[model samples]
Target: MSELLHLGALVPAAVGVGTLLAMRRDAGRADVLAAVLMLVGMTDAMTLSFVPPVVWFAALIAAGLALAAGRRFSPVATARPGTMVSTHLALGVISTAALILLMPAMPSSTPALVAPSHEHGAGSTMPQLVGAGLALSTVALAVVALRAERSWVHRLHHTTMAASTVAMCAIVAI
Candidate 1:
């Protein structure tokens, strides 16, 4: 279970980095900031299940600072007049905030979930199912953003940050 959650965290981090690289040519300050914020949140998720809470605590703080700084320093964010800018910031902050709230609530030592084993019931499996659902949702959102008439970067940023939100939910349930 922990391993799966950890893997889940890695997947999005990789995706964020790839998106960051893919967007670098056209990325403004806000886009880069948003990408970095997503990376930080994803990093925190990876640490939550294995490392001490202090690591994630630091990540949470860093994410908060980045969000604030991004909003203040990015000309595109401030100069633009659209929901996209605010939406990215909101998703990043909300995702990190939820992780901050949920970390301590997780059991410190949960037994590993065995595949094809009967030790745990359907109740225990719910988290995995939910995680899968969220993962699928992320894919669907990405596809929608790809096909949307709006600027692909803006739409994709919205979709990518949203992955962080769902990823946190999936991680917590795990």
Candidate 2:
């Protein structure tokens, strides 16, 4: 059931990416890059065992910083004042990184409770805190996305991707 929940979180992300790519011609470079980054972060979250946690942490941080900096420094993001897709995507990536870093080492398929207790230390609560933070950030992004004057497709993509991150965060906190 836990595995199903984890995999289920990926569905919205995949759909969002597909939708964004399908309408890439209409999207700004930042929007397209953000969507791709969100998808990559989600994929890494689900496949954490394939690489070391530290590697995932470093990669995600770099990706998040790059996304944020790219948006801030890019002429496109500066020219467009209303759209916050890149901001949303950067937060999602960073949130995923925090989730990954806080999570105790365990096989991705194992339920959190099923993992050996020793794997969970006094810091086990950190993931829950991070999850809560991510949830709040997701909600804020949702509001921004809804209010943005972008196309419906872009708004939908942002919403779905944000939802996917929240779902993954919730699952990890479980």
* TM-score of each candidate structure, all chains considered together: 0.50, 0.77
Poorest 10 consecutive residues of model 1 by lDDT?
109-118
Per-residue lDDT tens digits for candidate 1, residues 21-84, read: 5654434555455556546545543553443444555655566566556655664423334334
Compared with the true structure, what per-residue lDDT tens digits does model 2 show for residues 72-143?
776452345566666776777777777766654546534442323345576668668878888888878777
Per-candidate RMSD, Å: 7.6, 4.4
Give Cα distance to truth, residue 1, candidate 1, Å.
5.0
Return the lDDT, model 1, position 85.
40
Q: Rate the local accuracy (lDDT) of all candidates.
A: 0.51, 0.67
Candidate 2 Cα outliers beyond 4 Å, as residue runs = 23-38, 77-80, 104-118, 121-124
**Clashing residue pairs for model 1:** none
Candidate 1 lDDT score at position 154: 55
Query: Model 1 misses residue 91 by how many Å?
Result: 3.2
List candidate 1 stretches off by more than 4 Å.
24-34, 37-41, 44-51, 69-74, 77-86, 104-149
